[model samples]
Target: MRKLIAAGAAAVALAAPAGAEFASDPAQHLMRIERDALETVSRDRLQRLMRAAAEADEDVVRVSYDGDWLAGQAAPDGGAEWKCLSEALYFEARGESVRGQFAVAEVILNRVESSVFPDTVCGVIEQGTGELYQCQFTYTCDGAAETIHEPEAWAQVGKVARAMIDGAPRALTDGATHYHTKHVSPRWAGVYPRTATIGVHHFYRKPVRVSSN
Candidate 1:
């Protein structure tokens, strides 16, 4: 009879949920955050889970990606991905309308999706960050301190970054993977197809080809 009992206790141990792991793992923290938001999981256990996740920068954005949840969102908790997006919006389109800001975010997100660019937001934005003037974005290599003196602007842009990171739709730039402000027209602008003009910026995308027999 004992020999016929398959795996018994050992199998049960393997099946135990990831509850014990919630303390040290950020992935576990995300699960805990979702559970806590729903208020359906072990509430007391979630407190510890959340504490673990909040210690890291990337996982905090998991809970407050929506604009409505800004009240509980902590901007400093953002990891490098969030920082890149927020800084881009701040320097590129903070003066533009909210729609335009989102449009810029859309462009950055589009770059992430494209095969030519990096797979992650941070990688795309920081592609040319260290070069003198060849950096993809001007602010990165322009020698200005990447400081946030405008709390209000930072907060708003933080929300935009979170929104974009959470897979927000990309409609503003017409799938544009590149953009330049109206003040300067780079030589590449003539080669790349102009997709749309949003606020002070001109958006562009590489032309799609139709195969001809």
Candidate 2:
């Protein structure tokens, strides 16, 4: 703190014009210098505080289902993990509502957290590749080219994926790691405990197996 005050005092002294005078009296000159130094110190402290706040805010991804909030966010692009998540949302849940899209993203992230699924976003999404009807996500095994034809929808879902990847709360899905569209009742859906029904998808979490002695 003393160093900071000394630095502040030096800065204020150096910032003054070449011919500027604080006061004729030595006492008053010292008083003016001290006041200016204190003000500079306060401003410097405030700037540091503001920068810390901004950095903390950047770490938190506010969970909001509002379309306006998502649309207002800048276009997001990231590494392979982010791209895989964005593509998953684009192909699997682009048509879903903003809340639904977030829900789907939550499921993917929840899978990453689960011991049963792969730990990474890309790994989780591509768990079963190159095998028709054997992949976890149908789009990967469907054999059809994963072409992104709709830029607007892609952008929207990309925002959702980015938020989820940035640690948005997965409250909508209740820690669900599996989801299937309502039109199809997969064999696993019958056994997994249904946690959430959002938009056209049914979200589920695998039941915990109790080990008996």
Candidate 3:
């Protein structure tokens, strides 16, 4: 009986670690394994959760633009560009609504398409002249070091940025070139078509006319 009890105790001890490992959050466990394996986890998993949060469903893990809040958040190195853009948007327009943030991204992409601006987002954002706001984004020229203070906002923004970069349809903006909060309307609104009103901001697109010769 003593030998049998000892064998049972040994088995329990061996099984404890495996049970603990299995009890861990599946998403987190997979993430850790992926990180150790150098495998890239799809950003979609986080993006879907973010979209749900944006729609006011907060049961999902709360993310923010502040780096401090994300100290123990998910994989840090996942999607660098997405993280960069998200941090930029957080610092630039955290006060604005989600739609406003998307509009800001649209404007950056629009500049990429225009002949007057650089071809890439980083290029367009960083393009500027000395002592002047020559760049497409004022933040890049305003001499403010891009830093994330709100982790939840940054995480959500990271999801949005990742979705946008991955060719998720830009259906909300309708190719909008500009947007502003409903509290104030820009003069250019009169010349453009109002495409969408999301959150506090109204999105406008440049009207395209088909010429008849």
Q: Rate the local accuracy (lDDT) of all candidates.
A: 0.75, 0.87, 0.62
Q: Candidate 2: worst 10 consecutive residues by lDDT?
A: 22-31
Q: How big is the positional error of residue 144 in model 1, measured in Å on the Cα after superposition? A: 1.6
Tens digit of per-residue lDDT, candidate 3, span 61-134: 44343344434444333454565566657766677666566667776677667666677766665677345566
lDDT of 2 at 2: 58
For model 1, residues 146-184, the per-residue Cα lDDT tens digits are 887888878888888777786666767889988998999
TM-score of 2: 0.72
Q: What TM-score goes with each of the models?
A: 0.62, 0.72, 0.51
lDDT of 3 at 122: 68
> What's the C-alpha lDDT at position 23 in model 1?
35
lDDT of 3 at 169: 49
Highest TM-score among the candidates is held by which one? 2
lDDT of 2 by residue, 10-37 (tens): 6656666666574223344555767899
